[model samples]
Target: MSGVKRKHVTLSLNEKLAVLQRLDKGESLQQIAKELNVGVTTIKDWRKNRKDIESYTITIDGENALKHRKTLKRAKLELLDNALWMWFCQERRKGTPISGPILKEKAIVLHKKLKAESEFAASEGWIDRWKNRHGVRFVSISGEKLSADNEAAREFCVKFQEIFKENEMLPCQVYNIDETGLNFKMLPTKTLAASNESVTGTKLMKDRITVAPCSNADGTHKLPLFVIGKSKKPRAFKNLNPSSLPVYYRNQKSAWMDCNLFKSWFFDEFVPSVEKNLKEKKLPARAILLLDNAPSHPPEQELVKGDIKALFLPPNVTSLIQPMDQGAIEWLKRRYRRKYISSILEKSEQGFNIFEAMKSLTIKDAIYTIAASWDELKPDTLRKSWRKLWPEVMTETDQTEDQQNNDSQEIVKDLQTLDPNVLASEVEDWITECDKDCDSYEELDDDQILAAVIETDNKETANEDSDCEEDELPTRISHTDAKNAFDIALQYIEQNPTSTPMDILWIKKWRDTAAKSRISCAKQKSITDFFTK
Candidate 1:
């Protein structure tokens, strides 16, 4: 008897990027092909077209392209579409209200201006498709005037419960994801002053990054952290491979989450992680991913896969019932701040100049610390965060408000210890400082939009000049140097009575891994050899 033929899988642009990232990490074509359930030839084709794939993947239109499958087709009237999109962005940035008819008229004008050889009607069908392709939507100008609709939230909860029962979804099969802004380098606003000393405040470091955390209700699986920053290549990452970083890092001019980035993250990270986790737990591949109505989020229709689907929470009620907003994000931030402060204090005690130490903090350091803090978030804390939205998921042993309060108090105490002038109230303010301006989808102002346009135009020139201004690459540690450092640490631990047997064992294990890695690297020929040969 013959076996049934396997169906083919078409990868989206986001998925292609994920595949590229894996290949960059030196995964073999066969290995990736097996994992993705595709043939090696497909992987080879992607590798061959890597440059074109990367070029399209970074453009404004490219980011918001279809998420279901790869679409390399240009608009029937490419020049007209480009001009129309640019005009639309300019008007939107100027806070000018745009209607469908207005857009169509503008498109017609642009078509005429471009003097394209092809005829252009700018019909309603074309407008609708264009909007979908670009991920454009009509939004309220006075968004601030709206308030949370409690009645709607209550109704949605009942509807949500019905869907939950109908789908036969377990707590482990359901997930929630949200994004929060981090002022990664911000310090406390209040500090202690000598009785007779004049106190002056330094400017706040507003350097920002956006972090998106995802986990199932049971907290059995936490997806890799997705981070967005202002720079594509930060100086601190020189000589370091970004693909090897703990978190999945992306970049935008505003360091904010947008439709393109979110869509990419959904397909590239969330779906695969969830599918793998479900398989490991011996559960069905079916699941539901709950999201808020952030403007950046693609519509639910676009998010459906084989057995997984995306569901949106009722508008404006996210603050009340969103799982992450309930306390998960706040707790993560508090944990991150505590870890950051502890690092500074530890180095200061080691006799390093405090100012220099603080100045030395880099995006790379912040990223590793964020990953560590997320890992440290207890499962109980995550499960309890769902109480307001899905009370039945709660257990008798779920963490309580008092326990969380105690954690906050501990962080406050640490802050106070770090700066004698810092008050409990000040620490409290500082902890929530990033939350104030870090909306998941920050609308660009007129000036910001203009600046972004300019930046996009000059991106190639900027990339060319970046190398000349980059910081010196950090020196690589050789295998011998690594062994010596490990040996020194082992010697110190042997002399210290407090050091455990496990500590010595960890050092030796690290040494072995380093040695093995060095051997592996020595056996692989450099890419330069291929071209030279």
Candidate 2:
């Protein structure tokens, strides 16, 4: 410990945490001394500064403080703050998730209304907290008791929990689906209160290169009825011409996301593939589709109008109940982002062919990358938001009787799975496993890589000089070409590999001359001789 008693200091909570973490590690006292660049006692005194944090807890003891009080005490409001913060903390603990300003706007609306009327309101940092922001604002609260725990709350829970049980979704069949905007550009994070020469002035960047597909379910390849915007633009806003968000858009030349860009791909390309699989598997033709309230994409009104029917999830509850965020999407993204970044470093150290590079990786490899962070993305992480959201979902009816039964069944299963609450421990376990895979990459020498590039660049020289250089060796080129040509015909036979007797005539007509030519030309001759049928 440093000898100097520390002076009063003001640092962001993160900075405080960093200092505490370093101190907890029992690392170099000398390093600590050098950091504060003061006497050893200064750091020692700083440790004492942590004790002054005055651990605060709010508890209402009046006979009817629980029933009659319209507003909460400073301590009570502080408790709510702690709860919301912890709610977010749990979400973050599972994965690196954060909330943002728009969420603050929604979450603060009630507290704002309450603050305007209540005398105890000044004690609550309502405005400061409301101004809090996150790039991924997944949680918000009304500063009121999330009614799901009350008698009304209990009914709501029972409803969904009952539905979850009735469905008997067999683990795999129970799926939560939701769509999110894959923003082409992201905004920067800022502080609620601009600090006095503090507040971690260094800002963190917000944009993500890929889409975030988070769900409340577990496992891999809960592949979606993927809807891609075909327009080769960004995924949502089409009417805005290319240069609208110029300064914010990368390189000032990239296209905006559009509904048009994703429509054709979703309708034509994606649906056909999913439908094909459903047909092959003999699955029920109808699927439960979770949708958001965004008017920009296909709205719920459009679903009925278009006759492309799907079971809509309860409006806002999808974020809590939907399986997409159960770690699948986030993991998918983490894995892909890491692999993509790693690939850029390895394959195209100079520059890579993006399509060819991504294509080279197996689908499973891509899954593994995403799975790496999957566990950290858990449903419990969003429990705070879910608690607030549950009652609202219960009030809405979006189900047929059968659908209701299935949804009820799934809720029971989920609650039973989470009954004892081992979520924090499970998330920690996942983190340990995931971190083990960090920085595991193959090393490649630049010179060796450059040499391979040189070989490719010089291939023309080898081809030009090949004819004159061969001494008197038997040129096996004809034999190799003949064997390759026969292999193609043989392959066709292998699949339809059994050639008929006229096929023998075809082979004879073809093999004698066709074996020397391309499969395309040989196919023409074969077709010419075959019956029209």
Candidate 3:
């Protein structure tokens, strides 16, 4: 039999992109075919279906490539890129040397580990393509070890560069938003504990408030902090001006960031603030809000208005490349802890029990500290954190390990002065302990806790009714403490006749859920009482 004729050669995605680029540059099909060593018929076919080719195109690493999800081969290439990047970062962190030959060996092993097609050749040419795709540059690891995914980091850097280039965005137009859980009962790293004792007797409260902090890449603009708490109108603000607090405060049942609240914050707080800032700066009100794909973030389907664009960081890579994760949130938490430590010392001098004083620490005080801590974060620190993602914005005077060490040492010294018996080595352990008993206040039996809240609301309402002394019928009626919350919700709806369908739906769901919980608690309580009787 005659030898089988060869089928058409397959051009890689990059090559296809190059061919397309050449075609767009007005190159003749014949010239392109000669240059690429492909048939004129093949070139003509690719040119004919240019739109389809363009649809599959995406810029990967740095240059144009086919989107991985388009084909099995592309998907494998993506896996290789990700696995290689992960390995490279891990090795770099371990202070190991990396070279071309070593990288090739690692690539082969990674390919096998990924259970990819064994026959697929991961050759030196492929490695070279990988390097060029990601714009990877080999440099010796220096200074402190850090966790980073090299491919992800490089991708972010390249993508960020492209965004800036395409949008012609100023540093102020680009922003990153992140939320952190701030445990109010958190104590300093040092405390008065017995020498040589393995455990400290004190338990830290795990009661937490979530704060969303946003700042631009250039550090020239910082958005007002958005705070979430359990109470919409906490007793802490009873006698004070809530407006005096620096943060934009809202509340949820869990005191955690939720999608609805995040949306509200985006439209009501973030957009308005950005608009004002733009007006002040005499710049157009356009923004690029970079966010993590956290569950609390609104689903991508939500429409963003005006000239704002929402960009999400790659999954699982936010921790490695997010500016807030780098050090901004950590620094703010440290400052807050330092303030907490100072408060402990002062209250102790005045003969207040340390734990009790902490329990009495109000949301107002926490907000104050949160604002102050944010103020303490240097612009340079914020800019430096973007180094892995946007190196162009990084200042030359990045804080050295020694400088960070000195700052840490100062905190330790201050903590030591406050609690003489506290050991330097144990400071971090103590800080970790501060979040332990955070939910202690909420540990009561479900029914009893609900009853207490209802009772408080009843008393407050009675006083208001007495002051008004109108003959108008009560908008809500609570026959027992069990139904108080539902009644209050009903009252809220009745008072706000303009409630949207969503608001009404939420109220109904909330009331039904609460009613079920109340009934469950009551039945359990009755059974316990019957057994005791």
Candidate 4:
């Protein structure tokens, strides 16, 4: 039997992707090879060509590509295919209905523009194959309607309740995760003005950052915010370690969440954080993660681990049932806006021009504010957010709607105080404005999409040139300086009559930590000095 010739087995592209996902979850190459009945070198090769495989999966028709057992073939007219796909994606994102004829016409135009030497005709057969290759379909675009199915929402509620009963899941064991867009630099669109005076408005700042907030039903654990931005290394992050920041930062050409980024976050950040939280609480590692059916989110099968599972909410009912969408994201944005407005007010009082101060607001500033705002989100607020989705989990002690409204009203009043022109209505409008055009996935422009396709075609990583205008380097603080600052803080706390014992203890702890770091950085003694000592 051992001498018999072995049959050759070729894994499909989808199978390779699954293997990569398992590898990402820390499965060893040898173990995967054993499970798949394939050679270790085969697995190694797949892992080596992981990028190309993944790129092909994304750029081509996702569904049909799954059936492809061999290496993915490049399109005959690569440039035209790339350009047409980019146009299709952009148009679809804008809710434009694209017919088959329209797509064919676009492809023909792109082929001509690309100066392809091969004679080509865009026929019905070409359109059919193109659709199959790219996973295009003529289906009603439900997203364009922007309405929830109440019946579906009710049915899903019943199904969810059944699952809850069957699993006997604890509140702390169930989690909901969602992403929201934040126009960090946006200001109120409306303002009060004198009847006789004319009001002027400036163009709205469209710069956006994506923030994903996740927490359990009981609110015992809140994952560190997963933030996505456009720049890999923003000028604002100079001299600062991104990992040291409270939020987890990632970047791409578009700051939107994609399947790859989400997959990485799930395995790396979400799983580890939840495992730690469950362990701390003496709960079982088994848990559930609820996600929406956004294009950015990977399939549930890819997200499953031992005893933990990811489930999708009923489609088109996310707005009606998603726990995070209920109020958590809105609360975060409101707090962030309040912090942003307060900063502007502080800078104005310090004699800086108001518009200049706003303009100077950097990604670094926005990140810290986002972290602080997330921290300020009360556990009760988080628990209450689940009321719409999991009413049974809500405790009587959870914050009431009136209480939340009062909190929002207070922030609005603060904003009004900061700017006399700011109206309460305008503040409320501004708080929710960032979300108006927010889609879980980013809509890439033609150039960005084409560039990605081209890179994939060339099997190369992007080599972005450095910005010509270098930002000023941030001032560095030495360990000694940090230690001295801690000492000053301790002294202030010790002398303050109003300071509590806990405050003094905290200052001492910080001072000790800083002191230890400072001592660790001290120069080592020479052999002569050691002998003399």
Candidate 5:
């Protein structure tokens, strides 16, 4: 397909017949070939299509195969043992580097063990497809493991299913909660050789943006529970933004986001509210709070770990198995950050200050930013936050007519559509365009595992940038603040060699400080060399 220009060139029946007639009338082979502008052999093919070609037969097995004049092929078994084959292929794919032969052997063993039967299969193709097929991504982190034995969480998930199924509790009653870290440097995926060092390096990659996100199967979307904590003067409430939760929660003492505050909010505020909201309905078999194991919530986790009745999910299952992991938090953050980014894009550096800009937004404003981003993040958000992060392809069937109608009305109002006819046309146009785009997007396989690595270096780069952005970072020169600026720059440059130009934005602030006093030009030389280096 790649190299061949024309795999098969064919003529219409009439064209073929006419060509044959011309060739039969003693026309020169060269002249006819030149006239038709086809290869000389093509003329032979036209003739062979009728007169010269003879019927032939192939015998695959025996005399019966000859009598039927058909090639008999062996029938292949369906091999319901497929589940393990799929699982093995998926796990080995994440830089695990299982060779083709090993893959085939594993599939054979798995097929036999899982299905209680074994049959030969074409190893090369089947194993290749099994390992490479896409889909299961939400939970495939480096240290994360998959096992059928982790049925406890699934059992716990069933309580949610029962709550929804009993003809009483709809998805609205169920909620999944978990915390995540969203550091400035959430590393992008890359392909690298699998090494034991990198494998264990999962534990070492410390730079992160962690926050707790919650969700349920209900159509409703709400913000994640922000427990803002701080190392210094009351943790900043800025942590609870769509951008990050910790940024807003760090400074508050009795804040709803802090661990103690979160405990109070849960036992006092959240639980009481849930009870008050639905008076007639029974409380969820128990309030199934989905959560990640964070050091901050040791009391809560320890309570669950002890004989106390809270059911926590199994280890390493949050990515694929946790519903919140699928999208709710990511949606909130992405939408929140998109606005933050859009604000940056609009200002083009000088339009506004990023820190001061976000500092002014109220909680209500921050919540709205997340709400509006729902549509954009909906692809990742599933009905149950427990499904972890998997592909959810949106379709026309996904929306009820009433929902569609409501959305249509919303578009009209938001765009301030004065003309009904124009509005109608725009709705049709937008839906058509979106459906086409959705169709082309790749569908992920429901089976494969993704073991993504979180490289540490990427976080370092982000830290370098963050440190520069906030000019309060420690300086090098003690003699004078002027030299301090240059010394700081030199130290930063030394610490970071591959830093880009935009990263040096904070240098100007130091220069401003220098102009007010006798600046140390000596340190400036070192900083300049640092940049050059």
Candidate 6:
């Protein structure tokens, strides 16, 4: 018996757990070792590290690994796993690319940081398992240079510091203005489709809208959004007043921001809004408006009034230094996409076809969602985003980094619950898509994938007529269209029984206004006018 040979067998995580559970239930480690054909010290060590053993939640693939009798080589480093999890998320939030080799090196570094035993080996197999456990995968990096010119970035930072110090500008006195395109039809390519059905149907080449958003450094001033669309008057807007909407709307043949429009926005919208914001805050009207030198931006050094001045970032430096590009716009897009998904679920629940519900998403809906998204941005996010460009301006008092990490976990959880078949990589892909625009503004280019400007003979004739010296006629809505709008509002109120009293009152007032406006409409084209006049 003393000379009997025992076969060497590796225990899987489950076997390890079983042995540990037996030890927990008052069974002696010696008894488990004898029964499991292992040394007593192996059982004793498993019992001593029960917390670490229990903390290792096996994933579906990990469970499959256990079924195939795979050893938990990397998973055994529970403390290192916990530490690496935190570090990985932080790096991911900073938009840092973590390749397999880079992560392996980091794991080795973290082991040294944690001062773990020299036995901690981060093998390639362990790295793959670790990635699966943490939902990490290699994604193609887009719209960012892996390496930036340090000298150029430093020179721009110096220039920014000078301008900022010269102006003695408060956080609210400084601003960043940028534009992005929202493709309303863009949906996450992941969905819970029938097993036999192709998921490629989710892709739609929908039209895009350009949105101009501006925010101050202190997160105090989020100006009203300026949304540009190809259609000057959408059918959804027929019975509505454009000026009454929360966003300022504009139309262009190309649906792109141009110098003429930028100039008008500067004088008419941006300047006035800043003045009013400053007045309310009891600060001077003087402020610094930081802009990237895009072709659409007008070249105006001096303001028509007030001491507000425009500062342009050096060419090719925006990705390295722009605050909005760092994270603000990315947060807005993520929030907007979440809202869009929420709307789809809500409308689908109310007996509407999902496609039809998505089709009903108008520019008004986009404006509201985009504005709310901008408002939801943590102030710390705004300040920290400037770290690349103006690290000196960053403050240490913000808990946004932790909050964002928590929020991302919650989002992944919610999305997984919504569609269990959804891939973790798909969620990450959606996030990467959201982050793409943060690197640069959407400049109009000849090779852009945007829709071509649709032209027709009738449209040409209308454009010609628009240039004529015709008298200004009062705008009017058709009585039938007005009635239909009122009915739709009433139906919405009826369907949403959760509507508050204030909501009902607003609907009533809107309906009454629509009715009165229809009554006061200009004389309709009549048969008598066609013959006599």
The numbered model that scores best in lDDT is 4
TM-score of 3: 0.52
- Segments in model 6 whose C-alpha atoms lie over 4 Å from true places: 1-147, 192-203, 300-306, 391-396, 401-419, 434-533
Model 2: lowest-lDDT 10 consecutive positions: 186-195
lDDT of each: 0.72, 0.35, 0.65, 0.74, 0.40, 0.63
lDDT of 1 by residue, 294-400 (tens): 75665565575556888988666888888999889988888888887778777767876445445567777889999999998878889988988898888888845
Between candidates 1 and 6, the lDDT winner? 1
341-420: candidate 5 lDDT, tens digit per residue: 34433443454433333333333343344445544444324453334322232233443223334444554443232222
Which ten residues in a row are the worst by lDDT in model 4? Answer: 460-469
Clashing pairs in 6: none
- RMSD of candidates 1 onward, in order: 10.0, 28.2, 17.4, 6.3, 30.0, 29.0
lDDT of 3 by residue, 398-496 (tens): 654433445456657766665676666677665545544433112223233233323523321112222112223323332245357666877788679
Off by over 4 Å in 2: 1-176, 179-275, 304-308, 311-319, 347-533
lDDT (Cα, tens digit) per residue for candidate 6, span 145-258: 344556767898888888878877787888888877777545555553412334343233334567787878877778877776656665545456778777777766545675
Strongest candidate by TM-score: 4
Q: What is the lDDT of residue 272 in candidate 5?
A: 53
For each candidate, give its TM-score against the true structure.
0.68, 0.29, 0.52, 0.70, 0.33, 0.55
Q: Any idea what lDDT model 5 has?
A: 0.40
Candidate 4 ranges beyond 4 A from true positions: 1-146, 158-173, 189-207, 279-288, 293-315, 356-360, 399-403, 419-422, 434-441, 445-451, 456-473, 495-502, 513-533
Q: What would the TM-score be for candidate 1 when compared with the true structure? A: 0.68
Off by over 4 Å in 1: 1-145, 192-206, 352-354, 400-404, 444-473, 491-504, 515-533
- lDDT by residue (tens digit), candidate 4, 384-491: 888877887778777555544665687677556656677777667667665677555765555555565566434222122222123354678777787789889888
